[model samples]
Target: MSNLQNGFLLDDETELKTLLFEGEQDHLTPSTSRLLLESDFFVVAGRIIGHSFLNGGPCLVGLSQGIIHVLFGGEPETATVTESDCADQDVREVIRMLQGTKDLSEEEKSVVLSLTLPWDLPGVTVNNRHWLQEKILLHAVLERTAQQVKQIRRGLKDTGVWEFFSSRPDAVPVLFPRASEAEITPQMVIDNINWPKDEDIDEDILSLDDHCLIMSFLRRFIENGTSDILKSLLTFWTGWGVVCSNLEVEVIDCSLPQSSTCFLTLKLSKNHKNYEDFHQDLMASISSAYSGFGQI
Candidate 1:
């Protein structure tokens, strides 16, 4: 499921050409390419998303909300379409112009007509400006890719979970979470850790200086890192981008960091000289783990 999602939807390679969907990071909508429609790629994508959710795997995050709404049987006209939902800059600009109260110039009218002409939509006029605006929004968000969206619905039905999805409106967000909802926070990471408790240490003394320093560095790094960096780290630690519960951290006798994904344990070397050394080793270890290098 992860491979399918990564390869088909989220991969950088697919962004160069329209295979199934369009848009950069997140905000993906169905493509209107006839070849893609004939290939039934979107149906396969829908199956991947449904099956992934059923198996406790990664959801198809970053899908356009308007598409999702229509996928779940909501009316295209009622589905919210904003400028951000329109991938084409020209169409988005025209959408903005229609949203405002000011009348367009003759040249601007020509541009609007030229853009909408491809969709067989009527020309914009004083009487039908608002109607044209709605039509343009629908065209960009739903009408252009209507067949692709229909195929996605067909694909969802193939998984047998379509009824489940249709019945429970709440599950839509869980199965197709927005990019922001899936974001990991520093506190989330910190709270999930099962901090080591040393029974041998005296009550008067706190944690060892080296342990304290390394832990502090870990927190600081997490707090300051970008979302991608954090996700990479999570993937390194848990063998998946999603965080697991009760991750155990151990300060042990080792030359480099190591993780046991099955046990959710992370072992860090206690011999770091300073933050620089720790950061260098940590990053190297994370890179190694991510690439499946230096694993037993």
Candidate 2:
């Protein structure tokens, strides 16, 4: 659900101007400045992370303390703020105590203003800016969503091409496939005299060459312990290219981009037994679905 449905105030489309103009009109400038006055804390003890300033104001926070600090566009220099250690109570306990509402005095708020905030991050950049500030907040949300999708896919244990493809709603057609394809067998390659993966062929002979090439590629997937990689590759493949296709070829991957991968077994029918027959069918179907992926 979207943030608006849950009544959350923090949203990408939230307008800072509307927030700043909420109350009294006379002291709007000072009140707006106060609303923007966010401090960065260094430690749980409430040492100043960086002094807060108005948006578009001079003071810019750095990501780290040691980096020569400067106020906005000035030459890089050292920060003037001093760091201090508070008494050893956990900071959250202090926050709870303050929120209990035993009626805080005006003097107390002024003295302990720094204690109210959490941590002091070094600096803010366009990458970390707010939505009403810049567009980074939206991009961060998308990055987080992508990471979650990857995480969910990793948690599944299914190894079959059909089961794996069905699990993800967003994943679709894989490589091209034939209508009545038969289980692919090693004998099919050994029995078929001339196959496509071979170089020389007469125009009259229909060879299983492409099937051999695909089988070899499948063999490479397992040659280097890339079952999980094969799964992802197949996920994109079957999810988008072929609807419900299966293969029984070996994979011989040299190396993988990450830790885990997957492999599948392709079963072919009697008439569709040879590699070339399946390869031709797959190529034709895939070309119709996604035109350019196979060419490269």
Q: For this target, which candidate reaches the highest lDDT against the unseen true structure? A: 1
Candidate 2's displacement at residue 25, Å, is 48
Query: Per-model C-alpha lDDT, please?
Result: 0.77, 0.26
lDDT of 1 at 284: 82
Model 2 alpha-carbon miss at residue 186, Å = 18
Tens digit of lDDT per residue, candidate 1, span 164-209?
A: 9889999788888888888888778888988766564333434566
TM-score of each: 0.79, 0.19
The 10-residue segment with the lowest total lDDT in model 2: 40-49
Runs in model 2 deviating more than 4 A are 1-217, 225-228, 240-245, 248-296
lDDT of 1: 0.77
What digit string (tens of lDDT, one per residue) describes model 2 on residues 1-296?
01111122434585322221111111111111222223111111011111111111111111111111221212222323111111123332333334444554666444334432222222222333222111222121222123322222232212122233345423321211111131233333234212233343332333455345454543433243233333233323433211133332322222211111133233222234445554444334334322233332
